[model samples]
Target: MSPQQKALILLEKQGNFKVGSRSIPTPGTGQLLVKVYSAALNPVDYKIQVDGIFVTHYPAVLGVDIAGIVEELGEGVENFREGDKVLAHGNFYMIDQGAFQQYTLAVATFTAKIPSSQSFDSAATVPLGVDTAVAGLYGKHLGAGITPPWAKIVNDHEPKKPIVILGGSSSVGSYTIQLARLSGFYPIITTASPSNEDLVKDYGATHFFDRHLSASQLMVAINKVTDSPIRIVYDAISLPETQSVGWGLLAQNGILVLTLPALVKEDEGKGRKAVHTIGSPHLPHNNQELFRSSWGMIEKWLLEGIIQPNNREILPNGLEGIIGGLERMRMEQVSGTKLVAHPQETK
Candidate 1:
């Protein structure tokens, strides 16, 4: 018989998540089988359980941010060896690739070694959030088509340009603020609760505002900061009100990047665009190369403190703790922190 491992399984569409036993999967070519130590919870996991979105299979596993030690490598994989501590972006559509299991397969392209100074719990907070930020900012088809800082293009940054990010304290939002700073966008304006102003500023937000401000108030506040066109508005929250705020702040020829589907309609006369980003590296967009390029730099970035992981709160009870964590996330209780679980500690 094949090896077995503990997994958080979703029984069916819109089903409950339960800790269960499942056969451990083997790595295919160019993949690594990882012994998961830390699995970070995201809002999408709860959304999948309640809305039955993104995932189509029954009895499925759903987690995207994984951190652990590499146990085995498939044929043609050379960048990593067994026992190397790594973080990977797991795919929600692939049951065996999900992070909710003790043993899961990770594509080598999307995996990066974690710095020795970082714990597995902290490293687990990076993968999905950073990828979503990178995808929405640099992806030609999936985002605003901005030039990545790592790209060899002559004009890689817009030091004179201004950008706005809603939900600056979120995992995705925090990463976006960091990347925006790296991309040389000046006056990186972001909105969050007043309590999280320092946290977002630490992530490189140049200016901060209370998120409770009305759309008109935000427009007035932003106008006082910059006269330059607001070319990119990254709405990480993408709620109806937040979308309205973003849409209102966008300049002519600007693009509003949304993590969720856009609720705000675009005005063709103004030449503004609303882009819905797909963060999955496995997707067949023009973004595969971009993801690979960014993944290659992830280790160096983490080691050099160029990209900081989110503040993480480790959950109790190993795999069993994830259910409660997801509930808290669904109820909007978690903020400014990632919730990490240890699958290997499961009973």
Candidate 2:
């Protein structure tokens, strides 16, 4: 019989999450079996439970951000070995690949070594957040299609441009701000509560505004900062009001990138477009080459501080603690921090 491990299970569609037991899965070709130390929670995890949107199978384990030690390697896997500390973007669609389990399989392409300077909790906050930001900013179809920093033809002295990001404190938003800076965007304007101004600024936001400002007020504030055309507005929050503000701020022939479906209609006369993005690397619309190239650099970036992990708050009670953490996220009580659970600590 296969060995058993504890998992946070979603028993049914829109059902309650419970601590349960499941068999530890073996690694397949080019995969690694990781002993999960930390699993970070995202808003999507809670939304999946509340809305029953993604998973089709009953009795599923759901989690996407994982940080742990590789325990076994599959055939033809040469880049990683057993006992290497690593982080991976989990694929929750596969029951055994989810991070809620004590042991999960990670694809080699989506996994990276955790730098010595980082912890399991900090590394757990990176995978999904950074990948989502990458999809939104660099993906050809799902995003603004901007030239990625790693591209060969990218100019080191490219002209500076202006950008606006709503919800600068969110995991995706914060990563987007940092990538925008790397792409030579100037005056990286972002909106968030005053309490997160410093945090967002540290992530490379050059201008900060209170999110409570009306669309007109935000427009006025942004105008005073830059005269350049607002070519890209990333609505990381994607609420109706934020989408409206982003749509209104976009220039002719520009694009508005949204994490959720776009509620604002595009004006054909102005040629401004709104694009909804799916951030998963497994998705067809996400550029495969882009992620493959970028995932290779995650370790180096984290080591050099080019990318910063989200501020994380560790929850108690191991796998059981994830239930309360998801509830806090759903209630909008978790602010400016990612929630991480130690799955191996489950009893």
What C-alpha lDDT do the candidate models reach, one value each? Answer: 0.93, 0.92
Clashes of each: 0, 0
Which pairs clash in the backbone of model 1? none
Which residue segments of model 2 deviate by more than 4 Å? 153-156
Error of 1 at 169 (Å): 0.3
Tens digits of per-residue lDDT for model 1, 54-94: 88888899999999999999999999999999999998889
Score residue 186 of candidate 1 by CA lDDT: 88
Which digits, one per residue and each the tens of the lDDT, describe model 2 over residues 1-347?
88999999999999999998899999999899999999999999999999999899989999999999999999989999989999999988989899998999998998999999999999999998899889889888889998898784656686789999999999999999999988888989999999999999999999999999998999999999999999999999999999999998889999999999989886558898888877787665568778888899999999999999999999999999999999999999988999999998887
TM-score each candidate.
0.97, 0.98
Question: Among these predicted structures, which one has the highest TM-score?
Answer: 2
